[model samples]
Target: MRNLQGRLELCSINTATLGHREPLNQTIERIARAGFGGIAPWRREVEGGDVPRLARQIKALGLSVTGYCRSTYLPAATSAEFSANVEANRAALRDAAVLGAQCFVLVVGGLVPGSRDLEGARSQVVDGISMLLETARECGVPLALEPLHPMYAAKRAVVNTIAQALSICETVDPDRSGFIGIAVDVYHCWWDPELTASIATTGQANRILAYHVCDWLHETNDMLLDRGMMGDGVIDLPAVRSCVERAGYNGLVEVEIFSAQNWWQREPDEVLAICAERLQTVC
Candidate 1:
């Protein structure tokens, strides 16, 4: 079965690519019609207007949830800011449970402005995740710590490497617990010298919770939102896929793009069509 392309359960779409145009219900229908196995939606989409209603819509469309977009942004300068972030995560976690999402992706917070203490931010992240892991486990939702690229180390996430994410998980959960894991996205880790080894280690520990796919533009125009389409960029996606598969991660390969200028301007159906084509050819 090595030549069988593994399984067709590999295709998923992140709803953000279509956020500029489609409603959540319409997007789900479109994605489902495109033969995708699952979709990962952002909290903004989930809370756009209604949540329970949207959850029902997702189930009716017969689409699986790869994972929730995010829940953690724990590094804050003040107690009030920290508490607010915690509350947001609690709400997001509940939403994940309601939608039967596979995991609640966590972008552990980065350095606050004017603060250079990387270690401090990471400690806060660990604390926040530790505090929420219990509630996550109780709700039957997994928390997938997403290690963002170093480019975002100062503003989005301090956990910038797979090794760092796994270390935090190991420390917070210690016993290689089931609910806390990592979300590996190609765009974030393609340049990592330790990616392959980290994937192997994560797999052996059974901490590979979610897998996201996207191409990283060589001439990255925008640091935050300019993600390229699969084959349009330079990432060796299939090679990454090989690593993930070898590591025993057979979960959906969710496609997450934040192309503010490219994809977000296309028709939702057109985006889905392209995604379908790319899923076969590029991803």
Candidate 2:
């Protein structure tokens, strides 16, 4: 496994860790100044803004866009809604290209709006990715299927395991042209019994796109928030990273925490400093 050893350049920060408290440009600046090598910005952060200029700015600061945070929900209630969602994802891919992102992260949506068809929603997800593969290929941005934890299966994502994401990749991009892959977020995947084997399979296929880190609090009060910082929760992060490394994933180790009551309340600089510190130590 790669050692961070105080090497901030080997790490990235998803802006949500700071709760989206500042403008995206300012956040990018702060992240670069803090010595992180990359930033993963939410799409909402770029809406109605100067994308090309911002991309240039991020480049000038020497920070790469690790991945664009997330695709629009694929399993909507209506055909028009699903088409619109696909279009939105296409737009996101275009922007990711302009920003020179390494990959465009896909948080495939769960059960369709107002329905209980789990398998149906998953079908939509696969179809949506198939529809977007051409755009992703054209834009030169890989579609990274980030499987949210199963708890999010009802709303956020239907693909909740590395194996599931990999299966989707094989189905959509069987030749593995690098247009589709998986983002392994520890918070979501740490509990899978097939974690190691599934990840190893992904590695053999070269489908691991990004690796996210955040501790799952033992008695979390909120599902969305309450993410523990490195070493604060019970997850053995090092073990997860080892599995990821053994899978041949050599990308930035991204820190993605949603601590509404704790880290979000602190100064962004403080939060960043701690992230860097923990990346060198606990994580």
Each model's lDDT comes to 0.85, 0.92
Largest lDDT belongs to which candidate?
A: 2
Kindly report which residue stretches of model 2 are placed more than 4 angstroms away from their true locations once superposed.
Answer: none
Give every collision pair in model 2.
Answer: none
Q: Please, what are the lDDT tens digits per residue for candidate 2 over residues 1-283? A: 8989968899999999999999998999999999999999988898689999999999999998999988999998888999999999999999999989999999988897689999989999999999999999999999999988889999899999889889989999989899899999999999999999999999999999999998988888888899999988889999989999998999999999999899999999999999999999987
What is the C-alpha local distance difference test score of candidate 2? 0.92
lDDT of 1: 0.85
| Clash pairs detected, candidate 1 | none
Give the residue spans of candidate 1 off by over 4 A: 1-9
lDDT of 1 by residue, 1-283 (tens): 0221433456788888775465677788888887788988888777747787878888887889999887757999998999889988998898899989999999887798799999888888888998999989898999999999998898899999999999999999997669899999999999999999999999999999988887988898998789988888999988998898899888887888898888888887887777777767777
- Clashes per model (N, Cα, C within 3 A): 0, 0
Evaluated at residue 230, the lDDT of candidate 1 is: 84
